[model samples]
Target chain A: MGWFSWGNKNQDISEPSRQNRQKCWETRDSYFDCLDRANIIKPGDEGNSCAKEKQLYEDNCAKSWITYFNQRRVLADAQKDRLAQAQAQADSARK
Target chain B: MREVSHFVTLMFSQRALASLARRTYVGGQQTARHGRRNFSQTLKRQSQFGKDRNTIGTLTPASAAVFVATGVGLYFYFRYEKQKLLEEREKERSSRQYGRPQIGGPFSLTRSTGETFTEKDLLGKWSLVYFGFTNCPDICPAELDKVGTILNKLEPALGKTFLPVFISVDPARDTPERVGRYLADFHPAFVGLVGTYEAIKGACKAYRVYFSTPPNADPQGDYLVDHSIFVYLMDPEGQFVEAFGQNTEADQIAARITEEVARYGK
Candidate 1:
């Protein structure tokens, strides 16, 4: 399809190149995987087709997952501080 | 300017859509006198493509297979070796980054098994310690998972010498039994320790941890404990080896732990 579209120079202004544009569509599979994992794109998820479910997930799930990863870092830092203090105390007692 | 650049990169060279016009221009069939020869040549070329292109005009399936296989083989092999290299790299990374002992002072705790575990236990072997509660929802679960990943990454090398301990902050609820059950979610070798409030407080204070119950009490009378997330790595000498950041990926943590153990002779 990209090969055919390559010669169609008169295509719409908003249209992306067709060469390796198929590669960008690779995210489509993972998008569906994400939706399936989140349980938002099931056999009965309202009227959402694969495209809509994928779009919704790309909009929402991607951000939330990032937030989840970020929060876990803060949690680690707090724990590190507490543990580091214990280490300091032990060092002092050793002296 | 950015839009133009984006348009150029995305619309033009990206898809190679512009390149297709050059290929078909080799001469359309309408311009040919030997139209049958042109069609025959195209069909032969197409069939030759099916059989193998690299073989005919730098198009051989054997060579292509060798080429593609080289790519795919390199891909899978790199994935294979990459996994091993990553493991080796991880092993190297852990050894390199496993800096400084995390346990410095007192780390005394009364275990559910009726044994008192102190820094002395950490002195003779490598230890992976965690300060979390069974009740914690997100933070605790994530940290424990990290500890499990780190241990799994280390246990292979450190063997039985690697000790992964989970000390409960909410001792009242995290009884020995609950701790046992909670360990099920992580590495089996995970040691679950529960003590009285004082013993736990002493341990947490020794570790410099702070935890407060949620301001809004559990409406159903169930309490929520908000605690920090960190996996404490203690050296064989029971000194603080290093503490990994919460956001640190599991592989990195494992790499660090492995590095420290190798340094400490784990």
Candidate 2:
């Protein structure tokens, strides 16, 4: 659900940590900036601006954004997996 | 509060034991330990502080250690319960959580129709709310895909009953038209929302969500937003019923949402 909904408190993405928050913010900004640059460079309202070519630019930007997030998502998943393994090891050691 | 009660119980029981010891020492039932009255008074003050949220009550060394662990356990338990309740409540905000209905604030947001949508509009309908920008690279699309999957799954059971909503965080570029086109890729059933920066900020604040621009090492750049990711379920009558996280399975989410619809008498 969006931020306004209930049941959101338990989300791992909702966890408050300086590093995670910073990383999210940083990555998002860099990606968006890339888009803005693309947005600016997109052929303007001039009659000669090619519609199909402008779409090509937009599509490329969208793909780049997807790639960045997918890489980040993979890293995040790996980190969680590593953490779970460490916790399991600790539990066994305690036992 | 629970912690304080447990401590008070421990202290009282310990006092009873001390009194018994004193009775044996003096060979009389009326006898008391030295400074017993003062110790009891101290505990009373401690409990009061706990009630005020100014201090946490402590127990004897061993008891405190065990109690501390339990307190930690309880904290996590309550957090988990609250999350579940939030999701359930959003599923039936006007209906109930794991418990009873709780009131949420009434707020106004403009939808893609260029019409101002308020909490009132959300009432009498189940809304699956998502937050992201049209420029979002990954999470937003993934989440929206999940939404599409969920809608496809639940449409037969909940046709025209549930509403999927997308609210844009990047107002700098995500106009109503942009959000509309973006959501169209996911589901025709999706409703797009975009408003002034202040308007979106107010809603986010009410929800205790954090979204901020990443500090840039460079000067000229359009920043991205870091926001909470969950699909909020707002029940008929505009109460937050439930929410799902980034990885919540689509079928599971649709099931819970459907269950809420039936259980809430809506």
Candidate 3:
């Protein structure tokens, strides 16, 4: 009787505009997941969709979506780098 | 240039000597009032000469008795002052030991019983708080089971009751009724808390718990929330004591909590 996970069942997809936004976000996630699965984007590497060589099917993705996803990814990657650097420092201090 | 250097040195020496003399005079005055004889030999000799006149002929019995009584009084006075200082130092050390992390604060939430609960309500009793959503597939239920079992075991042995609290991070889906139903399956004494997203977030921040909803989750697909899986032990004063990680066994957790509650009783 349950078609989906109860936690995700309440997502607002009634409005067409909201549906488009959700679709765009899902597509971006899929593109990133595909890149990750294909080994095109390695873990711990800075994901820069803005780079011409790094663009993941830019023609298929909307420009606004691409910009939004790239900005968020860059911020997350920067935070990861900081966390790694802090971990290294702590390791050295422990030694 | 040599004459100027000599002049500066001479002036500095003069000032230093003057300050030393002033300090000695002040110290001598205080020593005189206290009948102490350390400041200056000259002052000591003068005090001894004056006392000798008072006792020139023979030691009066009244004066001898007064002297002995004053000596006894001085001994007790110094002993009492030393004891007070030691007690103050011990107090400072214990306060530093109780320097528990600043966690737990005012947060308005709804309990499973359709009652409003706040951090103030947790004032008088020790609480075991865990932050996780009811939809958690495995870890949340397993952890809650461990907590319930530990609480049950500890109660009979220690004869003490502890508030077992479950605060949901997924407030949007976890209504008070949903939380109530979920907790009912765990422990009879267990309480479930839910609130608006902002209120729940505030509580999480106060407790240093972290949770995030997965991004771009399918509306019609299975999903999981990523969060910290630690059961926080809060003392009666609403202060964080320690936390038990997910991997900790129920027996070990019970032993640890028993030791903690015993220590808390003291």
Candidate 4:
């Protein structure tokens, strides 16, 4: 069963090219920006507000990439909040 | 007479009585007093032959101590030398037997050109292998770029001796043509490999790579694959040499590979 599958003929899926990946990132950024304007930290929480941008994001990017980017967006926002809090604490300490 | 008896006692204590008895047996015609005179004469002859023999006859406490110390020192010196030789042999044997971990093994995968690539293809050239997917947005691209930098650094000194390879862990999406197109952005020398899921799994197992790609997952499903990010360096004989982590700098990897190539076949 394993030896017969060694041929490349069985592979039906093709990976994204460099240009496709760039488009995916652009669409992802646009979608995330829309989510930010709607005050939505989670990707699915934007409801029908960012529908056009979300459709482009889903179309341009791979499924796995969309998932990763969505998770990274929330994490990056949390990290930004923590950094701002730390800065405020440091300023109070200096005074 | 008392002095003569003391001399006789000293001769017996030093095991010289055997020689004295031989002399007495040889001169059986002589009287007992004549035999005693012969023993004193024999002692004088021995003293005249060697200064060391005369010193032994005197046998002072300080000289005896020096003799015993010399014997003990020589014994310990030879013992230490023997021990050192044994340890050196053991070190050599161990290095030949188990110095490196068993990492690389037989694997068959497809190259970007749709050619069959096996473990035998890794022979006769140094190879740096990375496992990643083309869909990886950040980490894989960043690592491939770093590999490009390393290759640029290694080109002049190493020439065509080193090969940079990228094998896709996400075989469901990474077809040969797609892998080729993806690698075209990094470096012209990069050889991208893709295979069936089972084939990719076998290659990963040979290199001890871990990936969290479900076997029967839908190709269109949106799920990120969690995988170990490392670059494996294989020697010319297809043996595992070293592994560079994600945090290792390109210059460091290049320097290490240059050093390893220089040390090869010596």
Find the candidate with the highest lDDT and give its number: 4
For B36-125, candidate 3 gives per-residue lDDT tens digits of 234245444434655543442323477557656755666676678889999999999789668867777788999979999999878777
Off by over 4 Å in 3: A1-95, B1-98, B214-222
Q: Rank the models by TM-score, top first.
A: 4, 2, 3, 1
Give the TM-score (vs. native) of candidate 4. 0.60
Candidate that beats the other on DockQ, 3 or 4, i.e. the better one:
4
Q: Which candidate, 2 or 4, would have the higher TM-score against the true structure?
A: 4
lDDT scores of the candidates, listed in order: 0.58, 0.63, 0.67, 0.78
lDDT of 2 at B107: 57
TM-score for the A chain of candidate 3: 0.53
What DockQ do you compute for every candidate structure?
Answer: 0.01, 0.04, 0.04, 0.29
Query: What's the C-alpha lDDT at position B92 in model 1?
Result: 81
**DockQ score of the complex predicted as candidate 4:** 0.29
Candidate that beats the other on lDDT, 1 or 3, i.e. the better one: 3
Question: Between prediction 1 and prediction 4, which has the larger TM-score?
Answer: 4
Q: What digit string (tens of lDDT, one per residue) describes model 4 on residues A21-77?
A: 678789888998898799999999978999999988887876667778888888999
